[model samples]
Target: MNKVLCFDLDGTLINDKNEIIGGEGTIHALKKLQNIGYKLVVSTGRLEHDIYYINNRYDLKLNYAISQNGAVINKNKELNAKLLDKDEALNIYEYLKTTDLRVELNTVSNRYWHTDRDPDFPKEYYDSSNIVHDFRNVIEYQPAVLFLVIGESDKIKVVQEHINSNYNKVKAIRTSDSSLEILSEGISKGNTVVELFPNSEIISIGDSENDFSMFELSKKSYYVGKGSCNKATYNFSSIYEALKQIIKGEENGQ
Candidate 1:
């Protein structure tokens, strides 16, 4: 059986500025591991297109990519998606419309955002490509994986808590201080990875609350930066360092 290395995107693969400063070193390590027969997988909360966008823009490559926090998987050029319930999505959408939060609905192919974009929402994180004034009219026609609410930390918490308290079919989690993400209950990166590779050894690397579930399922895990992740097996300042260490361990027969 093969060993799979799964890593998060935002804080792990790229820096806070969205640049891969350690590009050459990380790419070398990844290529060496691939040559040694390791299956490299990029697991992220980003949508499929965004994953490819980063890969192309940075010249980084991986054998497989898991997107939408595990709701969508692209393996061997095939797409497998686990979409949220349409009615459940609509219910959440209806409730979110009542708030001033910047809501983004992520489908397998495209992302639709609320027209009432909050001015405070970080410009770097907001994508203005697709904006829908109202999702109710087309909610039933599209397949969605999750919904994202972006705002002040306090407002994000309030929406997350409300959804957790009222919604049975979906669950909400704080992915970051300014963002709250909602996905179907029981759907997570860890769960999806385990299901995809039942016989392989799993190694996870990430830096936030959303990566905790993936860490829990990993045989060895590394937490990047100072973010909280009690489940990680080790801590590193950057993904490049983690990859170097992983390569060293593999060469030493660990």
Candidate 2:
């Protein structure tokens, strides 16, 4: 039986500063796992465009990807599934305008932002020329796969509280201490993985609070040692070290 390994980017595969500290070794480890026939997938809160950056930068031939916190899944750049309901999506957009928070909306093919002056703006995302819209004016648009909120941790928490209090149509998740994400109520990394790989034994690895959902859905879980994730799971000082264990099947217990 072949095992499936799903990795969360950002802190798990890369470091806190978004640097590939382990370099080619990490990629090599994944390649070795692929050679051994273990299916590998990247499950992340990042947009598909962001995923493309890693893919092109690393020259990796990844076949599967779950983006926008599992709101969308794809294989070979072809859509496999999406989790947004039009009504729920519309309600979220309406509710967001009541808040002063900056929000970024991600569709299957594009990303749009309500504000360009946001200090926490993702520079890389802006370079892609994703649509920019003013929150108050845009209406009747389809529900995006994911919504990203970047700000101070305290401010993000307040926004999350507001959403929890006012909205039941969607779910809000915090991937990092300073970011909040909104998605359809049932959309999650676990749900998407189950849908995509129904029968495979799943192993998930991540390094932050956002990864909790994936951890809940996986048969085995691991956390990179550098982040806010609990110390209970297997911890590695570097990606190469973690990859070495994974390729050897030695991290299975984690």
Candidate 3:
């Protein structure tokens, strides 16, 4: 039986800065582990486009990806997507609209924002070429697989509290301290991993509170030392060092 290694993109595999500044060794180490039959997958709150940006920029080849915090699962190809049902998605959307909050909808291939900003909105955080749409009328369409709301910490908390209080139909996850993300209930990184590799032993690596679900489901969990979260099996100073250790262990049949 083969072992599965799932990595969280932003902090565990790369870093908060998103430069891949010190993960080359880690990538190489994972690749070496893959060569020895350890399956490597990425589970992240980001969308496919975001993952593709990192892959293309760094010239990486991943086996599978669980995106939108687990609302989507795929194997690199856009055509191989598994998304939430339209009715379930719409229900969450309708409930969210009743609050004093803005939402961003994400499909398997595109992301739509309910703002006046152009579809080609600029992202100051990372170098991304993600397709953005000005979905002024979101209700016109069914709910998307992923929905995001960004604002101040207090506002986001209020919104989260409201959602938790009023809506029990969706899973609301806060990937970042300032952002709230909603998805279909029971849909998460752990669920996706089980769906794809039911029999494989699972290990997860991540660095945020949003990764709690994955950590809870994993047999072993690792966290990047500098990330926001504190629960982990091991804390590493850098991705490179972590990968080297993982690769060496896997290579030695440990």
Q: Which candidate has the highest TM-score of all?
A: 1
lDDT of 2 by residue, 1-254 (tens): 45788888886776645656588888888778777677888888776777777877876667688887787777755775464566666677777767676777766666677556455443453254355566333324644566778778898898888777777777788887778987778777878887888888777777766677767777667777454355325666665776787766644643
Which stretches of candidate 1 lie above 4 Å from their native place? 116-128
Candidate 3 backbone overlaps, count: 0
Over 1-254, each residue of candidate 3 has an lDDT whose tens digit, in order, gives 76888888876666546667365666677777778777888888777677767777776677887777777777545544445556666666676677676677776656676554434433423432233443424434634566788767788888777666766677677777667887667787878887788888787777777777777777777766454355666677665666676776766877
TM-score of each: 0.91, 0.83, 0.80
Q: Residue 25 lDDT in model 3?
A: 64
- Give the lDDT ranking, best first: 1, 2, 3
Best by lDDT: 1
Worst 10 residues of 3 by lDDT: 121-130
Predictions: Cα RMSD each: 2.5, 3.1, 4.0
